[model samples]
Target chain A: MELLGIANYLVLFLTIAGVYALLTLGLNVQWGYTGILNIGVAAFFAVGAYTSALLTAPATAQPPGPGLPVAVGMLAAMPVAGILALGIGLITLNLRSDYLAIASIGIAEIVRLFLKNEEWLTNGVRGMAGIPRPFAGVDIAGWSAGGALYLALTIAVIGVVFAALQILYRAPWGRALRAIRDREVAAEAMGKNVLWFRLQSFVLGSAVMGLAGAVHVHYAGFIGPEAIDPLFATFIVWVMLIAGGSGSNLGAIVGALAIWAVWSVTELLGQIPEEPITGFGALRVFLIGLLLQVILLLRPQGIVPEPRE
Target chain B: MVELAQLLIYGVVLGSIIALGAIGVSLTFGVLRFANFAHGDYMTVGAYLVLPFYAGLQLPVAAAVTLAIAGTALMAVLIDRLLFERMRNAGPLVLLVSSFGVGLMLRSAVQMAWGPRTLVYESGIQLPLLFGPLRIKPDHITIIIGAVLLVLAVHLLLTRTRMGKAMRAMSDSPELARVSGINTAQVILFTWVAGAALAATAGFFLALDTNLRADLGWHFLLPVFAAAILGGIGRPYGAIAGGYVIGIAQEFSTLVISATYKPAVAFAIMVAILILRPTGILRGN
Candidate 1:
């Protein structure tokens, strides 16, 4: 069997990194810019993926494909995912930060549980397969040009969202969000509706998470309940935000890419030639534990602290 | 009448674990002032710790358990001293995320070490005690007795011992305690050791009934948190009572709903309590 070329592996990594970057940016808005500390960003991402996949995946008595055009399915998936986030925020966002974190964890689980158990809707644990790739006709021979194409699309989508977020960050509304996040009571005293601003952040973040999910499903060509497990959502997003620098949009993207590099390298390191290492796989986990412990101990402010400016 | 008795009996047994686990979690949160998302993993690690020594090494069950408890406690202390102590002044969010990262590391490590398979420790001693209208296992009886004794010990230590008093004082008001010349760091260490020891003990009991799996603590995490919140954060006794209540509610909820959904019951109670009475039944912060 032939090994994957470096270029192909790079493309795969970049595409995954791009999707995670989008998701991390959404979290940066909620946790960094808005101070919400949502631990369940994965749930909304799952929602968008499932909603679009269900809509687009072929059904009995229907054509054998995700039924709608890729673009339309993507569009419809966004608001549905946003609404779900809004529902969650309305119920749990009013609580204290710790409480919100706990609730978000629960909410993420609930979403995964629903998708896992709701076989009729999500096809249960088997997951939806054979998801249509965009611009399939332009595929390069046998190299899975689909990955490069998706990487391009992911870059495009991220560019649009990043630009839009940039606009929002400078706008008066974004300033209001920053104010509320810093001091909710003081922001309220200043005539800003704190709850409303928070809710807006939730909706917008969820929508971005949803869009990221849409790109993820289309790129991977498979979607599953386990894909949105709280482990990946909570841990990965937190790592990216911490490593990336939180409140900065650039920080979120950079963090996502950098952490992905760390994770991949660690996984590769686990495969190094070491005979009789006695639980080497587990050793890597211990390494991650050690790394996190050291990072928290030495650099709680992270590699790049959210810039004051 | 029979059904109610069974519910109460099962609830107490389940509650025993919840009570122990919650105290571990709540005490950490109370003293440290941040949510430790990884506390659940301690339960999983404790359970996993016993398997290697008890099953793999063929050590006697009691000896293996002692080792497990001690090992888990040491691990907790090492984590506190090595990781948590350094973040003494960071935002609570940093602590929370750190706990999560720690949890992920611990769990993945267990999975890698143990290969994600569930293993049961074969018991050499089984005294299946019989009670009128209620079947009880010897392990269950041991767990209840142990819980009661530990609770008493903790109470005495808190009220009678200088270290315990210092811990309570610090938890109540760290600044005042510091100003009053109490060694707050020592008190914090005591809190972790005590809490982690109880948590590991509970994890041992949990492994005794169900096989030890990597996700055992994650599965139990919600209920433990629910119990802690129901009893009110920072109140050890309240957490114990809340544990049993939550445990019983969880097992009984299965009678009406699917057994798989039993876990959600703990979370539901937690959400209700948080929304309706954030102060909780015992009214601690």
Candidate 2:
């Protein structure tokens, strides 16, 4: 029984880690290989989660879904987020990196406002519940096999994304992105369309972030404003990427696992009543901020530094 | 007509708060060559710093504010010395990311000390005095007066004072200023002091208007950035004008849109600016 409990916990941990790993990988495509500082990660995240939740959730759910297949909802989330990126990228990609960062923050805020105010579509702040999982009802050997099956699904998706991104990382397209990042003037001199390439990267990465959100909403069985807060959905992703080494795909995956573990542990620690833990949430933030600062200052290469080739 | 007038008044008052915040942001952006993301939290820190003096120790408002400004200035210097100063060579994006971390740290620290719940310095109902067709709160009047005085003082310091001139020189050309015998480090220190002091005042005024929460300054960050960018990056005078433009537009926008989407108004304006004139109205680099 203890072993089964431990196994269930492991399944939960890895499933969530896989979702974060997906987000980190997407971020790498933009910030890592392409050098696009997309600070509005939470916007794309919310877009993806809400799109899927609204599409796949049953009509009985608040903000009633069309009750589509889970696979269709997940697939549709990518383009919805991509379109958002396309619109924002058309305007913001031409600016300097810092300006892009601030503008991204604007987009995130706008998305948050949309989710909070568009109650008819999103069920307002109460968020839609009863989001069904793919294999949520399967049981075998007098025990539910749904947990293991979902974990399998998450791992499978991560595997596909990881493999595809790895190939892209080494292709000519990836080299062009690196060129644009390293020296935009030189890339322009070499006849590369800098703005177009950047927009493509931004859209692609954001689409992936949307997928991560879709996966997340399904596991949590709901979506809400809190799920999309920039501090959590966005800032933590940045921390994971930088902590994992930005330019490397494998590093992105490793970083997600490590950072998410630490975050989960911190939450567990916060629940202790006798530990003199006042404002545990704040302390965790302070710790992560300090961690990011220390890494940036000292070992910016991260635990799994980007591979040369 | 009355509603229009009231909105205009609200715009100017809000604009004053943002202008104060943007002045600090513009100065630092110009001199440091990076958008300090921790700037909003500097306002938060400065505001909370005053709470102990004004509310806890029961010091007079003026004295408490002075101490808070000094304390905030000192804290900014300390952060720069400890974290930012070392990353001087790390480039702007690195610095910007570091400021994000600094902002989280500052805000979380505030939460740890003050708790995450919202608090108001004065919870009593503030009755607005009728000024013909417009109703004006006394606090609004005080904020406007204080902001105008501060803005005038800043304008004088920038145009007249040697330190201010040196800072401007550095902003225009850091290397050239350095080679031309300007003490770039000293100017940087002065920039933080000016920015943090104004941010302190902005925070206090913001709290006067709304209750204090851990995320109060962060909530204002969008409009503050909008004002700074609209004014033109690194132009203090432009920032002052931009603040009013953004503030008033945001307030007036509530006529058509829900008030919760006020930040969206600023975001729309900022996007328009980015697409139409990336250099901002003043066209400063």
Give the candidate number with the greatest TM-score: 2
TM-score (all chains, Cα) for each model: 0.92, 0.98
Q: What are the candidates' individual DockQ scores?
A: 0.51, 0.87
- lDDT values of the candidates? 0.80, 0.90
Per-residue CA lDDT of model 2 for B142-247, tens digit only, reads 9999999999999999999999999899889999999999988899999999999999999999988887888889878888888899999899988899899999
Error of 2 at A173 (Å): 0.8
When summed lDDT is taken over every stretch of 10 residues in candidate 1 chain A, the lowest stretch is A57-66
Off by over 4 Å in 2: A273-276
lDDT by residue (A1-309, candidate 2, tens digit) is 998888888899999999899999999999998989888888898899999998898888776778999898889999999999999998988789888898889899888889988888898889889998878878888677788898899888889988988898888888899999989999999999999999999999999999999988888888898765576567788889999998988999999999999999988777777776778888888999999999899988887887875
Per-residue accuracy of model 1 over B1-285 as CA lDDT, tens digit each:
777787777788899989999988878877778778888889888888988887789899878878988888899889877777777677787777778778888888888878866777774667666677767787788778887887788789878999878877877887889999998778788888888788888888888866788888877877888888889888787898899999899888977987767777887888888879886798876
Kindly state the number of residue pairs that clash in model 2. Answer: 0
Winning model by DockQ: 2
Best by lDDT: 2
lDDT of 1 by residue, A1-309 (tens): 236687778888999899899999888888877888787888889888877776776544111354776787778778998898787677667777777778777777778788888777677788888677686556576666766777888899999999999889889988888898877888999999777888899889888888888888888778987765557565777778777777789888988998889878877776676754566656665665566667667665567776675
